[model samples]
Target: MGKNRDGGGKDDEIIRASDDLLTSLSKDPSIMQSIYALLPNQEKLQGARDRHRSLFHQVVDGAHDKEAELEAARNDLIAQMSLVNGMANLTGKHDPTIPQKLGLVHQTAGKRPSAAGLSVPENFRMAYDGRSIIVRGSAVKGARSYEIWVCESDPLTEASWRHHATSGKINRIEITGLTPGRLYYFRIRAVGASDTGPWSNFISMMAI
Candidate 1:
């Protein structure tokens, strides 16, 4: 149980624990399907976990320009933790033993992390270069990382948006692999240690 001095828990230890849990869940899809009814889909949860693991190793290697990668990894891990915690809470209400069986602790009701002090990002701007969209925003206080979401659907509603990327850099975050000449709506939010801030006003642009 390696933990940091601040008690935030060690990234390596977390990755190890998460890997074990993911393996167990993956080995038995029936149990996972039942447990995930009130939680995020298994694929999304595992994808986030894998992204965190990959980025964690990159940071450990002392690679250059890894700060942003580290932040993104931390953000992804945080989201997964939140989802697991919620799942634990829901499962505990029905059967206390289930959480332990799944390698998760029962989260107390109404004990979600507070987002009170976190502020939404400001001065967000965007431009397109070839097939990439360059986004910039003013960093928020106490922000651990930033998340970018893009909506490609027309008559864009709230549910149409999907997470695009996460980064530590606020000055210039480039999002590539977009369809050329397609219209895209983008927005950003700041992720704090305990919670996330509200998303900024979304802006639209042509990817080309």
Candidate 2:
């Protein structure tokens, strides 16, 4: 009735505009009576808009909740997939034929015979980068992993050495977040399926 303004906008915008229109119509009973007898009254239209507006808001909130649930489910599945693939890779390393049967690419390297006992890593060296140290050592045969140990105090004190990181790579391990000018002692040990080797001779490096 108020200049026949545009309709069919957003739910909240339309609802507010309808409320103002209803208030204007209530003040003028003459205009209300002039409405065709078959047409809905001002009160009925306002009630319908309010009901639908409430339902619209509920549906919007439900959609957001459902989206969050979907994201969490997807992340969980991704983590499980990573775990399964890592297991498959380890299995393939031991048995090269298994990867082909499982439809996974097998990395073919010269297969070294399994050692009776794990051997200690040797030739320990450290390079001083501007912000970090790159530690290297000779690879041990049949080694599955390398454990890096670091000592901030006296290297002679066995209790001072603490486990730093375990690397899948044999050499060129980068250690970061070191305090500048601090002297760090690092050592390495080879880990095999059946045995853990003794620690290598410690190497020292000063953080820049």
Candidate 3:
């Protein structure tokens, strides 16, 4: 037996001492073959673990991309719906009169007892010449007369509306004494003996 440099037994000495009791079994080559066979299985297990880790990361990344795409699609759908609703509201059955033109009146016989239907032409125009507004629109059917209301603020709000002009069975009316560079709202309504109709839709004009 040889002594180790570190004052321990050498490798060969240690092996030989352990083999003395099993000298016959130590010579069996089948035992050494069994130990070597387990190494390939260990390598396979390590490869499987690495592949599983890579697949997990791929799934996480895919989920994040899908979430982002869904969010973008939802926003696009909302914008499209809003545009459709706005167009529908503009072309609906409601009247399109300016605020300054609104008044109380009746149109039809039976309907005259109720509310008078209000209307305003699509091509109606308003122009301000220094001090007065020239409002032009076609006459509404069954309207005996029209009343025009003008106000600096919204006419629907109380204390903001003021009478600007009134017309007798005519389609055109000119409003005077209005300030230049100011915004004006107008509407028109029809009148009957018993009651006055609902005010027409409001239209706005910016005085030049």
Score each candidate by Cα lDDT.
0.67, 0.60, 0.50
Report the Cα lDDT for residue 33, model 2: 68
Model 2 ranges off by over 4 Å: 1-116
Task: Give per-residue CA lDDT, model 2, range 10-118, as digits (tens).
Answer: 4554467668779989898767667454244445445555554555565567755455545544444433333333344346557756545654442222222324566
lDDT of 3 at 80: 38
Positional deviation of 145 in candidate 2, in angstroms?
Answer: 0.6
RMSD of 2: 30.5
The clash count for each model shown is 0, 0, 24
RMSD in order of candidates: 20.2, 30.5, 40.5
Mind giving the per-residue lDDT tens digits that candidate 3 earns over 1-208?
Answer: 5554533335675576557637755778676678466333435545544554555465567756455545554444433333223223233326433211333121222222234453443234455432346666556555566677876643445476777666775445777776764556676666545445555545566454
The model with the greatest lDDT is: 1
Top model by TM-score, which number? 1
What lDDT is reached at residue 89 by model 2? Answer: 38
Candidate 2 colliding pairs: none
For residue 40, model 2's alpha carbon misses the true position, in angstroms, by 99
